[model samples]
Target: MANEHYAKFIEEAFVKPIRSVLIIDDDYPTLDEMLELEIIHKNGDLPPKSDKRWHDNPGRIKSVIDGFRQPQRPLLVDIHDGANVDTKGDAKVAAHLHQSDLLVLDYELDKNRPQDGARSIEILRGLITNDHFNLVVIHTSEDLDMVYREVILGLLGATSDELTEGEQEAVNQLIVEYEDVDENALQALRAAVATDQYLHARLHASTYMRTMGQGQQPYSDFCALADEAGWDNGNRRLVLRKLLADAERPLRARMRNASTAGLKWATSGVRWVKAESVFIAFSSKADHDDLFADLQNALEAWNPAPSRLFMAKLRAEMDEYGVVAQTEALERQHALAHWYARLLRSKGDERRWLIAESVLRHSDQLLNTILRRVEVFATELISSEAVAAGDNIEARCQEHFNVDLSKAAPKKKAEREHNAFVSSKSPQGWHLTTGHVFTMNSEHWICLSPACDLVPGQGATRNADFGDRTPFMAVKLHPVPVDGNHDVNSNLYIFVTLDGEVQKFCFNSQGKEAVSPVWRTLYAERRGLLDKDFGFKISAMGAGSRKLVATIHPAQVVAQLRYEYALNLLQKLGVSMTRIGLDFV
Candidate 1:
């Protein structure tokens, strides 16, 4: 199946005529595939259906040549065991090198061979230089680090030379930087060099450097040196060299990971093809999880009142763990601020209200700074005559809201209306009317209705109707555990209203497709309700119930409601919403 996939890929991708193919690998299966492809290409017909070769390999050769359309048949030059640098492999490659336009060189070859594919490429660098082939692709499952080093060396024109004075001095300096080094290993490396085993010496030296925490070389400096030494860009060697150089740089200012060493080549530039392993070291996973858990716990326990002393403490702890990246630290602080705000609302602790308020204010300032830059950019675009006069208002709106405003407006309104109705509908036996909006005058609460009996004489409430505005709040969907033989087949939608009310509604999971669109609309519009006045009209309207009923599980419902409320509060205060796990339902 894998061979068939590759054959089909080639047939479709090689729209232009392939003049010839050079298959350089010790792998018999790969060579056989190429040989069969070449035969099919020449015949202008696929192998007969009854052929046992096609049956054995199944779709491998048949799929590629069944409808092969190219008028020109490409000649094939197969070089088996080309990885053996000391053998006639070099002579055979050189003899047939000019006959093919494409070279498919494997990265790994026979384990018994002294030279692998990379080493062969390194040795044949001179012969393959200056567009010797129209295309050359390294195809292998070899370790990326080994491949990277070999490719760089090959591109820069590898040479065996007596160590220069500067190079020797650099090596010595590197050794000195290590607090401890194996004297035996160092002596062995020197002996290897003395015996003119330059390759073995370099390998031993590299291992020593790696063991002594000097594995990272100045990749940028190396690239510069290679360029200065006059390596040409005929095969995009310069581009690849630069990519490798950038990838070698530490992702964090002071911390480095082996996995990240050569990642830039894969991530940046025009990617032609890639083969990568997905497995990561378990230690890396453990470290990541530990750091994440610590941050989450710190955020949950944050108290920002009086000053941001709690945040300072968390930052110090994070710094000790070598997580001093400013952006990452600030993001954690922002999330903590939001998380704490929700706590204050749920607990209504007057003592901690000041702290929560302060954290929120700080978070707001940070968010404003980010939004201001976006606003400035948008304003500039809007002010520009060229953009304003264009017919792409949808594009402009997309730039602002990440959505097509013209298309979304009606849909958003419809969703909002549906959510309002759902919220007003009864859960078990309680029905609530649509909420009114009330803006916050200060951090303290203010009454929306002047004539209302809730609060007297503290503040004058003008008769203000803010319409059926849904309060900006965070919401989470949680599963309701069913009792044995129970019939409720839905989860609960818990909402934290703007004014700190923890409300919930039961939603059937079967209706998620209908509910998700409404929920998303509400979530998106929640920001608009910030610093706004909102209150819902509540009433009990089913089965002569004067108070909340026992048909629904109150304890379970309340627990989920509070949890969602706190989370929503954090989101409202600009906490990273990604932390909320709402997909369970």
Candidate 2:
């Protein structure tokens, strides 16, 4: 009744070891079967640790997480299932989606009531753009030939195949149990996965990191793939670094095994690897100098440059490779000590401080290095403020780390040299703001260069005054017939607000208005009768004394005014505000 055989495979292959899984399908039967299996097997009792799957073999789990290094996971959500997904259920679905590394969505629903496909995609797209992590997988069970000919090749851009014997059984069970299947469901699922960019990004990242162990070249290849895919963001880069670091975590465990076997592996000869119960291996104990050299060489070759951390790691490898050379070993020991000292003196997270302290406890000669690093941090605290606050170096120093310059001994002539060094290293004119800020409402804008006049609408009033009649009114303007290519001044937009709440607001660099091109495009594409759209509305005030509440139309000045204000705020914050445009329907 439980497909008793699957119970063993499920338990051994998934449930017992893997605590979490993403189940995806449009068929209620398939979903029921999975859920039943989970319930019957008590698999749901597994810990919901999204961060790691410890039940998996350490090596395997590492591979999986490494594969998922890209920010997002594939999420399988059955939006058509009014039971699991509905307008009201979207929030719940989204919450669940946020917890997963990937997304799986069922395109079809059993009701034949037809959920809006575009709307579903819109919701997912919105979340994907906002999150920038998570992979997506779409599942479908249409006829192989038809699917191959139509949806896969034409609509979804996926390759199709006949179901395998086991898959056939699953699909049969699904169809028999849930007789109501819609044709568009699978298409919707395929389109959702194929067209969305988040899925593409996640999949590429996961696949690349997953292949890190095959060789150094594969890891390099992955980095190239990332650059090509436009996933060159900070988090994506962090994944590459983490993958390398994690490669070190398990070396201790492996070394113990190698050491016990009397293997000549460099990892084992040194105490770099650890045993389950004890530190059986020592970094100095490893005897396989040749293996260590080769391994370190390979690792260095694989790691890209321009990273200070990577350089340090490379140096560590070189030291390991030259462990037999006493002179080189001494140099390396000193370098490592110096490195630890630098870490100790840095600012930011206290964990680095602790790590440095631990390293220092092992080597006292590192004291000088530590002191130097502290001076570097202190100098930074001073110099950065100096640049940002305009030569008030003391005030700058006080602002950054809350150091009291008033209490410190006056600077000596030599201190000027250190200041010069600090200035050289400090990023050009970039300074962290001290709490004390001086704001002045000058008649002239900050950029007083001759080209300042070229800055769009430089002196335009911040308020959107839509006549005096609508006092205390506010307005939000969006593109009219909102589905089209957006030209800020060309496309008309509707504004909504109380009609007269005026405030000075800033506009983004585009200077056209606050509306974004993408928003306008979507709005224009979906423009139709107001009553037909879920988000569109226009109404007059209620009760005996009636007045217009808000109107939807092109050329809405209120929307532009509000948008301008928001844009100004974003500019002040130094965040790019041009990503998404405004569109009104």
Candidate 3:
């Protein structure tokens, strides 16, 4: 028999509901069905039932949900058999539960049982640990303070208020906002404001940085869970808020985890790609006849410059000056600030890589004149930048805040060569060489011409390794831009930069798309800005493109290309010169 139904959707309109609400109670439709079947005794009441968890009046509760129904959005409902636990609380939530925009979970699964809200908390903690919580409403008749105490201890580890002054203030603000007088869906958001810091720490320590799942390489994304999350407009907002700071608080406790995740997001993928590329190259080498060519390819694939050793040194030297500042690269501003902040952090971290010697040079002056103390020690100065170890919850967890940084900005190229380049620490004689690259205006340019040609009024085979007042012939390299019209591998001559960007000549000289090529002249101690559009030169001679750059300075050399690849590039230059059959008079 068809039961009577209420109007929940418009038949004519095409647009469906935007959000889905799932209400999980102790008992609902099951109890409603029993009442419908006239299972009551003489006085319109059901006899003592076997199930101790059933609601006293489920029909009235169902009516409350029906009252919230609208034709504009979808709604879901479920009933728990029984639930109560201080520690061991588990809920068999379906994958589809991920689709919920607002989860209305009952605080007490069974009123007759203990007020162990762990069942709801367990469900919430799981979703949160995996970053899958929206607006959850713990609807109950009990006082809000009771639930606050339970949730704070369960998730936020309210073990001690050992927070810094600023952190204490931030936490207080978080508490006030969530403790809203109106018992609405957003009230239960306190659990999210101060997310499971321990869970995130564990995720980073045990799972990401250590060994778990793919072992910190690939993205820690729950693609299946995301797919299960509905693709509706409302669901997009739910996912949006996870990253956005409008409804969220910046977590000091989880800074380490955030940084690890960011680094993995940046470096890990490229590392994996390079490893795979090396494997493919090695595999091809076994089948190919040109062992050297295959080996060169494998070597290039295995180690793309700016070398790993350089990064290690850079990190090592930087560590000596300052400790790693654990700040959330993803906090506040628009939804995009998190990503932009991370990119800035990657570059801005160089600021911490200072010259300790510069400060130490004035140590005696500081101790006598500048220091009011009898003797000012280096440890006291170093203490200014020291990071708190363990989960101490210091006041400086996040200090810079929204204020502008008054200090001078970090430079792209460190004035001291050894500060930025690992190779610079080697012999000075090897600084200037063929195929050496110079970084300028945030772009990389390699010396494509021979050392003999770079020297002015030079012999056919002048090999001084490096000469003074010489114009080094060079060309800019850029990552291949895909336009679907030209093949990505337009030319065989390829290059890689210090930041691991795969690059090719600015001009694609492989045939149809080949353009006229030109080279810029670079010289030592010759300071001049490059042409506005140096990459798109239509002639060999250009304004502001030529300068007598004799020897490549230590500060300028970012990396050196392999001999084979450099030779191939030189060969391409010969081919590019003959690209035009004839010239106009």
Candidate 4:
């Protein structure tokens, strides 16, 4: 009775459009009386008598049955007495059995009628075979073994090998009745019988029962059954066969609807750029080895076209963002293109050489162009200032550079009070007394004597003499970390060349006060330099080293001026210094 309640619950929850329920039992009057009472209790009407045998308190039972009856879900009920089995009356029951959507039977229909259960089984089995019934339940109080042997096994055709005379008679009766059935229905019944055999071999009884009890649609149910059965066996041929069966063939629209619904459910909230379809067809094959491989190849070959389309769209987006013409973006594109080009033109080791050479050449040219611009800018700034200031530059020159040029011309060597003046013989043996005096613009002072060793290349040896001279006066450029305060060596100085090239150097503080402090150039280039190496040995220099001085030799000043003037002209022509990597500051 509990199983019957659960079965009714399952039917109410999952099944739909149940047209009628047919009951086949030995005691027809008692079954009919109980159904009437159940309906009356469902309508909230109590029985006139309080006999417990007629009706239990209805309570939850009324609610369950009323719920099943709402909106008249099941329209009709039919009952047939099993006492009329194997007679013309049985034929009348069979004639209308296909009209019912559900079938409820008594397992032991009658003690006198030995074939009553078999007759019930035959009728239900035929309807199930033709796919006319949605559900079937044997509601008898008989033993479970009797039900399994006489009803379940007989319906499943499991005991056909050892059928009794009565069972044989029931089977013959079904054949005779099939003659009156429609051709299409008979064909479907035969196909269903074959499918039942296949299902029984693969699925357990519990799996079949549960699936049938809860299934929504016949085709979908068959698919679910096949999936459960084949899931553990690692064989899907039977599943595919069931899905592709002619009797249960899925409509094209249904397939597309199911697929679309599934996709929507699976990909909810996901964003996609495009959706399209591709079709691949193959002839049926007995061996599936080639089937999977062929499908894979087809899919792989089809992928590149769509992939290329997506990449093109991505490239278009990058172009809109100005990324393609940007520095790193251009470099990456060039590198990939150049690598592939080289690989195509050369073989093996030669390809590597070609790629490396192309990359190095591109890098060198880029660096050189950047450096040239910076050098030119710095040089022009210094030279233009020097020429425009004239003699008024002496004050600025004294402020920036330590050189002072305020004193009058010296008289005799003996009258000179400062030791800064030198009296010496030139390498050519000419005697000369050299005085350091300001140049015409007063920016820098030079040796007055033409034969002085202070002339370019003839000066006394100093640490600064080891490097080239720039006309720009050197000032203490404060050192600050470009990125953050975490730099290990923040005390740095940068000297800008007259042509705008900047050199970074740090003061070496290792020695005692016995010697003048020396500044070592850590990084030097025409453009700009960023040093990463620290805590390493470097050359030392004195404060008076010419390398520390920014003033160029007088002989080189004219050349430096001419170079800057040309750069200024280029700037007027709309050339951007910063674009070429020059930092004016």
What does the lDDT read for residue 372 in candidate 2? Answer: 44
lDDT of 2: 0.30
Best by TM-score: 3
Candidate 3 residue lDDT tens string, 115-214: 7666665655555534332434455545544553344334442122144566545544433443444343233333322333233333244443232123
- Give the TM-scores of the predictions, in the order they appear: 0.23, 0.20, 0.28, 0.22
* Selected candidate, larger TM-score, 3 vs 4: 3
Residue-wise C-alpha lDDT for candidate 1, range 1-585, written one tens digit per residue: 112222222222221223455545454334555678779989898764332233465353333332222345434445444544542246556656555544555555555643354444443353333233234445454554455444433333222334457645554544343214443433333332231122222334344223222212322333343344343432123222223223323212222122211111221222222112110110111122221122222222221121122233232233233333324336667667776766656532232444545566655645444444334433443355244537875554454334555775544543443433443322211111112221221111111121111221111233122222222232233333211222322322322232233333333233342333112112111112222112222211134347633121111111112223323333332333333546776
Clashing pairs in 1: 305-355, 436-534, 437-533, 437-534, 438-532, 438-533, 438-534, 439-532, 439-533, 450-461
Task: Quote the lDDT for 109 in model 2.
Answer: 30
lDDT of 4 by residue, 166-202 (tens): 6455544443454455434334434443443333422
What shift in Å separates residue 584 of candidate 2 from its native position after superposition?
Answer: 70
lDDT of 1 at 276: 27
Count of backbone clashes for each model?
10, 60, 9, 9
lDDT of 4 at 377: 37
Q: Which runs in model 4 stand beyond 4 Å of their true positions?
A: 1-14, 30-74, 87-89, 113-116, 129-131, 158-585
When 1 and 2 are scored with lDDT, the better candidate is 1
Model 4, CA-based lDDT: 0.35
Residues forming the 10-long window of minimal summed lDDT in candidate 4? 259-268
